[model samples]
Target: MKEKGFRYSILASGSSGNSFYLETGEKKILVDAGLSGKKISQLLAEIDRQPEDLDAIFITHEHSDHIQGVGVLARKYQLDVYANQKTWQVIDQQNLIGKLALEQKHVFECGKLMTLGDLDIESFAVSHDAVAPQFYRFIKDDKSFVMLTDTGYVSDRMSDLLANADGYLIESNHDVDILRAGSYPWATKQRILSDKGHLSNEDGADSMLRTMGQKTKRIYLGHLSKENNIKELAHMTMTNHLLKADIGVGQEVKIYDTSPDNATPLVTI
Candidate 1:
């Protein structure tokens, strides 16, 4: 049965910065703050929210792309930042001021479910180059969503975390062939293909097929590389593979690619 009241939306989604707002029970939590504080404020205003409305900020990693605006937002909003020790270390390296430094932040290991207001937030390790990149699975009422991005490989544990999600925000970075032939240097290409690197489009689709359930409602393809992949190709590849698996793409799932430069219309769940 669906929860009587629960809502979520992506404030912004793309390679530059990622942020999402989840309203569970009576709490408003932001999953990340990678975009500029000014931009975040504008986006939140569009959704009828202010920075003060956020209860906390949950960080998935310390990559520059994910934490670029953390420093400014934290100081301005005084938001509680949640992350693990390793992630904190990387953030500290950025030398962000005030609340973004992670010194007075709350640190928690991945793989445990924690409650914030009425929401159940679970964090799990992901295969990325960052000190401790993590993925999130959020449950509110009876609805749940799994956000799996930035990782090069999907382990059994990650698969388990995603197995029962109602929606998925999965990374479909580069098309392997396109990446292989692109202008990026060989070393950079090798880095992206490593186990602890970014996930390619095929890898994302493969992971989705492995973890999807009948309850899966939508797939939001995210974190696409601007250099070597196109949104249409990612969509078509995933669609074809899902068909071969006896899964009618739109029958049980609706797949949408994230905007490479801006936010897609808020996906309410």
Candidate 2:
């Protein structure tokens, strides 16, 4: 019998690497594969999936923390990989990712829509340092799911495009005061706070408040910085924000702090 609903889980999330396992009854895809192929394979195994079972990979950008395992997974499994033209160009130009077969290479422009099995996928531009950074929204059978991370901010334009999702995995990357006081060099710190840098916990909480709707059922905070953001801090930050808005985390929406090292509980829609 086919699975009755859609489901997803964050396999691993952090600056070290990022990957998600997303599946409908008919399809299984990875949003990114930044970790080593071996690690990604093991993570998949934890969820009872094998690397060879993936239908495709949707590359958010060419950052090493997002695409490091692309080559290995694709070559090993003969899976299709999709990214925008600029991302493909840079990955090839910098020799960053592995050599993918021509047949396996696919490109989808920003603002365009594509269908995989029964799901419709859409990508939107985001503020990030890498070339052609984008996040995705997946819809199937009246359900909408999103993975919006690695961006400095989620703009109003994009928020409207993504509002009312059934589930969201958004970034809560750092704490402003913590990031400012940490031991990192000034330049690197500034880069993380720049218009194209990662979002702080405060900004992330605000993003959730703005985009979350009555229909939104869950929020998984992801991509936390190991040095600057504590798991409890991110959790409370978002919880307090929702509380102020009269949106209870457990009552109205489920919120989870995703681990950088382990897989989150499988959330099925």
RMSD of each: 2.3, 1.1
* lDDT by residue for model 2 (47-102), tens: 88888878999999999999889899999998899999999999999988868789
Model 2 clash pairs are none
Model 2, position 161, has a per-residue lDDT of: 90
TM-score versus the correct structure, for each prediction: 0.92, 0.98
lDDT of 2: 0.90
- The TM-score leader among the candidates is 2
Collision pairs in model 1: none
Error of 1 at 220 (Å): 0.4
Q: What is the lDDT of residue 158 in candidate 1?
A: 67
Task: Give the alpha carbon lDDT tens digit for every residue of 214-239 in model 1.
Answer: 88888988888888899899998889
**Candidate topping lDDT:** 2
Q: What is the C-alpha lDDT of each candidate?
A: 0.80, 0.90
| lDDT for position 21 in model 1 | 76
How displaced is residue 28 in candidate 2, in Å? 0.9
